[model samples]
Target: MFGDLTGIMGKLKETQKKIEETKKRLDSVLIDESSSDGLLKITITANRQIKAVDIAPSLFEDREQLEDYLVITLNKAIEKATKVNEAELASVAKDGMPNIPGMDMFK
Candidate 1:
């Protein structure tokens, strides 16, 4: 019984290490997405943090058009960030937990 507990503890420690490594990778991931017309740009981290936004100077005069493009670009950036984060997490899970069933569902 003591041996079994020790083995479980070892696995838990390994899992914790993997989780920390994966989090570091996620935090370092960066993605850039642009609007269809090339007027707006956004940079986001895999952990869904918005880092920067670049907008065309001409759009500054029209709040309505600027708002529309900002919404579209931000959505695309968020989607891209989410996909990257999911892929990274899935990779980590697969590497650390091969015994888990239905792991591909995370993809």
Candidate 2:
């Protein structure tokens, strides 16, 4: 029984390492989002770090409109980044997990 526990602990540690590695990898995965009119564009990492933003000169004519575009586009980019981050991390964790009898958390 102790041996089994030790093996499970070791597996858990390995899984944690893989999850960390995946998180680092996700830092490089970029998600791009644009406004409906294509006046604003945002790029973010799967880790939800903003990488770049490109705005069309037309959006500069109105401050409120530019702010609204930024809000909407950034939110969309963040949502997409979150989805990618979660999926990638979950995949790594699930694949590396040990087959413990009562551990069906992934399902």
Candidate 3:
């Protein structure tokens, strides 16, 4: 019936709003990570966008060492940011979906 269709459309609009809000929140989330020696630091958003990178002046002495540390630190920072982003999106999906029977198996 038309009434049922209208109700469903309303729910869909509300769910879309929640998803947009979640995306905005995720953009504002910054994940900071540092190298093992604390000589390197990187800041990235939950959406995997690099915001900033800081390296200690002392690291300028060795180019190879600096490159290695940068590579490792960058990879770890990206991985951490990606995992947090995925978890946040997953939470949104879980909240938006209806509680149907046997859904626990998928979760």
Candidate 4:
């Protein structure tokens, strides 16, 4: 039993390392989103860091409209980034998990 526990602990450590690596990798994974009218564009990383924002000249005519577009587009970009981050981290965790009785958390 002690041997099994030791192996499990080792596996958990490895999984944690993989998760950190994945998070670092996610920093480079870009997600692009734009407004419905294509007037605003946003680029963000899977880690939810904004990389760039492109807005059309026409959007500058109305401050409120521009703000709304920014909010909507940024929210969409963040949502996409969140999904990618979660999926990648979950996959690493699930794959690295050691099979133990009643420990089927991934299921």
Instruction: Point to the candidate with the largest TM-score.
Output: 4
Weakest 10 consecutive residues, lDDT, candidate 2? Answer: 92-101
C-alpha lDDT of candidate 2 relative to the true structure: 0.94
Give lDDT for model 1: 0.81
TM-scores of the candidates are: 0.81, 0.96, 0.79, 0.97
Question: Which runs in model 1 stand beyond 4 Å of their true positions?
Answer: 98-107
Worst 10 residues of 4 by lDDT: 32-41
**Residues 1-107 of candidate 4: C-alpha lDDT, one tens digit per residue:** 99999999999999999999999999999999999889999999999999999999999999999999998899999999999999999999999999999989898
TM-score of 4: 0.97
Q: How many angstroms is residue 29 displaced in model 3 relative to the true structure, after the best TM-score fit?
A: 1.2
The number of clashing residue pairs in each candidate reads 0, 0, 0, 0
Q: Which 10 successive residues of model 3 have the least lDDT summed?
A: 97-106
In candidate 2 the C-alpha lDDT for residue 20 amounts to 89
Show the lowest summed lDDT stretch of 10 residues, model 1. Answer: 98-107
lDDT of every model, 2 decimals: 0.81, 0.94, 0.84, 0.96
Better of 2 and 3 by lDDT: 2
Best by lDDT: 4
Order the candidate numbers by lDDT, best to worst: 4, 2, 3, 1
